[model samples]
Target: MSTILVTGGTGTLGVPLVERLRALGHEVRVLSRRSPTHPVDLREGTGLDAAMAGAEVVVHCASAPRGGDDVAAGHLIRAARRSGTVTNVVYVSIVGVDVVPLGYYRTKLAVERLLEGSGLGFTILRTTQFHDLLARVVGAAAKLPVVPLPSGVRVQPIAVEEVADRLAELAVPTPAGRVPDLGGPEVRTLAQWGRVYLAATGGRRRVVPLPLAGKAYAGFRRGGNLAPGRAVGRITFEEFLARRDRTGA
Candidate 1:
């Protein structure tokens, strides 16, 4: 059994991925900015050697959220190449990173390029929007009486659990370089999902459609970011919302 290292192993998806890998009898090591069993900072390039020592597979799931610097992912890819000890490197990226001109997506695309050029065996999984994103949108919209949604476009979001599973599966296989895009079983408009989220949360917020302008908004409105034919997730939006801790309460 090869030891696999997971960057950001304590994160939302990382937690479950680690647990699953551990159950499969693989030695699991985690890298994070704080309190990691094996503390390593990709940005600072510190403590990486100790964490990577003896690891055969490295699943690169660590990333900064929106508004934070994502160059760290690129740094981690460089570090993995320096290690030369790890085998497969699985990098988790978002779908439409090429089409979405957002800073966060742009950073991810750069990291993907870095991995491809690194000469290390790597697999790239570009997944659709996460189910949790819908919940976040609902929560943000609840702050105002009127929730504004883009009137013209649609989204094909996937479950984070499914994304995690795909990452785990790729860790053991040879680098399938740029695997097929993973999306949810259904497609829905932002307003439609917003309403479902509000109903599931028992919220009374009103959702108003808005005409979003600008290139980023147009990309989203034109469905440039969505991969409808790549649908693979089993969980529906309603199923995801209903499974929440306080659903219907």
Candidate 2:
């Protein structure tokens, strides 16, 4: 079994990715600021080398949407190179990071470039937004009597488990750079997703489409974030809602 280190092992995608790796019999180390055993903050690079020591593979799932992702990636790349033991680094990125002008997407794309030039073996997987995030967005809007959603904005929401599965498969000793994009089985607009949310939660709210002006919003409207041709994800938004209802998650 390969000895692997997973960053952001406590976050949304990190939690399941760590579990999946461990279940596969890999020696998995979770590198987190709050981790009891392997404690390290990616932003500060404190204690990172110790946590990364002897780790053959590193799955970088830790990310900050608000900012500082590039800084964290720089630290991770430096530490991985210093370790001299890390053979593969798997990074999870967003689908439209290259085209989208969002600040967060720009940060993600910057990190991708950092990894590309780091001289270490690496793999980058870009996927659509997660189902939970979409649910949260819809839920937050449902609080208002009239829910306002972006006009002409569509999203492909994929299950976190499916993403974790793909990440696990890519966490092998050998690195495969720039794998195929993973997207949801269906591409639906925010209005459609809001309706799905309202129907599933039995909430009564009038959904309104709001046209927003911004380069990022325009990119979204143009479907820059979509991978309709690579809709390999089997789980639909409705199925995700049903599963959440069943598990109360």
Question: What is the lDDT of every predicted structure here?
Answer: 0.81, 0.94
What TM-score, over all chains together, does every model reach?
Answer: 0.93, 0.99
Residue-level lDDT of model 2, residues 1-249, one tens digit each, is 999999888889999999999999999999888888988988898989999889999999998878999999999999999999998999999999999899999999999999999999999999999999999999999999899999899999999999999999999989999999999999999998999999999988999989999999999999999999999999999999999999998
Clashing pairs in 1: none
How many residue pairs clash per model?
A: 0, 0
Identify the candidate with maximal TM-score.
Answer: 2
lDDT of 2 at 200: 93
User: What lDDT is reached at residue 229 by model 2?
Assistant: 94
- Give me the runs in candidate 1 sitting further than 4 Å from their true place: 66-70, 246-249
Best by lDDT: 2
Model 2 — which ten-residue stretch has the worst lDDT? 30-39
